[model samples]
Target: EENRKFVLRKFQILYNRVLWIRDIESTIVIVIIIRAGVYTFLLVIVAFYFSNKLPLCDNEMTVCRISIAEVV
Candidate 1:
């Protein structure tokens, strides 16, 4: 019947909309995750570079050990 066809079409539209929203949300989440990972990597590199540049006290072998651990 025409009424049954109409109901089926409506359901199809709703299903498509739900799928579209889910896809958009997933894309946003992936982008955020990538950005966070890149930022963390950059920060670690910068910290390692600066740690090596700092002047160490004569008895501060622990500082060097800690810096090497962070780079690894």
Candidate 2:
């Protein structure tokens, strides 16, 4: 019947919308994870560069170690 077809079409639309939203959510999550990983990697590299460039003092070394730990 026409009514049954209309109902089926509506259900299909709703199902497709749900699936689209789920896909978008998963993509956002993946992007966020990648961004965080890259940020951490860059931070570590910067920390190493500074630690190497600066002459190590006891206090400065402790501070550098603490900062790196905080980043991790």
Candidate 3:
């Protein structure tokens, strides 16, 4: 029947729209998580390396460390 076909078409369109929105939301969340993880990892690595080096260096290294710290 015409009414039945129209209802089915409308449902299909709505279903597709929901699926598209869900996909976009999931993609955004994944990207954000990955970005945050990368930033945290890099920060920890730089901090650990520099902290260990600071105590073992001479006068020249002190200036270098200060510049590096400012850059970071």
Candidate 4:
């Protein structure tokens, strides 16, 4: 019947729209996660490089204090 066909067409359009929205949301989430991971990785690398570059101290107590402060 014409009515049934019209209903089916409407359902298909709605289904397609939902699928598109879901795909867009998934892509956004993936992009955010990837960016966060990259930022974290870069932060760690910079921290490691700075730790090696900076002069701490000869004494154990001074080195511990300085290193702890630098890490934060």
Candidate 5:
């Protein structure tokens, strides 16, 4: 019947729209997770480089203190 055909067409359109929305949501979630991981990796590398620099700074500070003591 024509009425049945109309109903079927509407259902098919709704189903297609739902599928498209679900696919878009999944893609957005994946992109956000990938960005978070990349930023975390960059932060870890920066922290590692700064940690290596701290010991040299401490050594210099100690040398300065010793020189000041000798002068006094």
Candidate 6:
């Protein structure tokens, strides 16, 4: 019947839309995760590089003090 065909077409359209939205959501999530990981990796590398380049504190009493080297 024409009514049945109409209903089927509507369902197919809705299904396709849902699938498209789901794919977009998953892609966005993957992109966000990758970006976060890249940023974290860069942060760690910068921190390690800075720690090696910076001078240590000279005061014996301040054992836990962090000393940043002054850049001229």
Quickly count the clashes in candidate 1.
Answer: 0
* Clashes found in each candidate (C-alpha, N, C closer than 3 A): 0, 0, 0, 0, 0, 0
Itemize residue pairs with steric clashes in candidate 2.
none
* TM-score of each model, paired residue for residue: 0.42, 0.41, 0.44, 0.44, 0.42, 0.44
lDDT by residue for model 6 over 1-72, one digit each (tens)? Answer: 999999999999999999999999889756655655555455446756888652333233133121111110
Worst 10 residues of 3 by lDDT: 53-62
Off by over 4 Å in 2: 35-72
Candidate 3: the clashing residue pairs are none
Per-candidate Cα lDDT values, in order, are 0.66, 0.67, 0.65, 0.64, 0.63, 0.58
Q: Which scores greater on TM-score, model 2 or model 6?
A: 6
**lDDT string, candidate 5, 1-72, tens digits:** 999999999999999999999999789656655655555455446756888543332347555334433443
Question: Per-residue error at 61 for model 6, in Å?
Answer: 43
Model 4 misplaced regions, further than 4 Å: 36-72
Better of 3 and 5 by lDDT: 3
Q: Which candidate comes out best when scored by lDDT?
A: 2
The residue pairs found clashing in candidate 1 are none
Clash count (model 5, backbone only)? 0
So what's the TM-score on candidate 5? 0.42
C-alpha lDDT (0 to 100) for residue 13 of candidate 5: 100
> 1 or 3, which is superior by TM-score?
3
Candidate that beats the other on TM-score, 1 or 6, i.e. the better one: 6
Which regions of candidate 3 are displaced past 4 Å?
Answer: 36-72
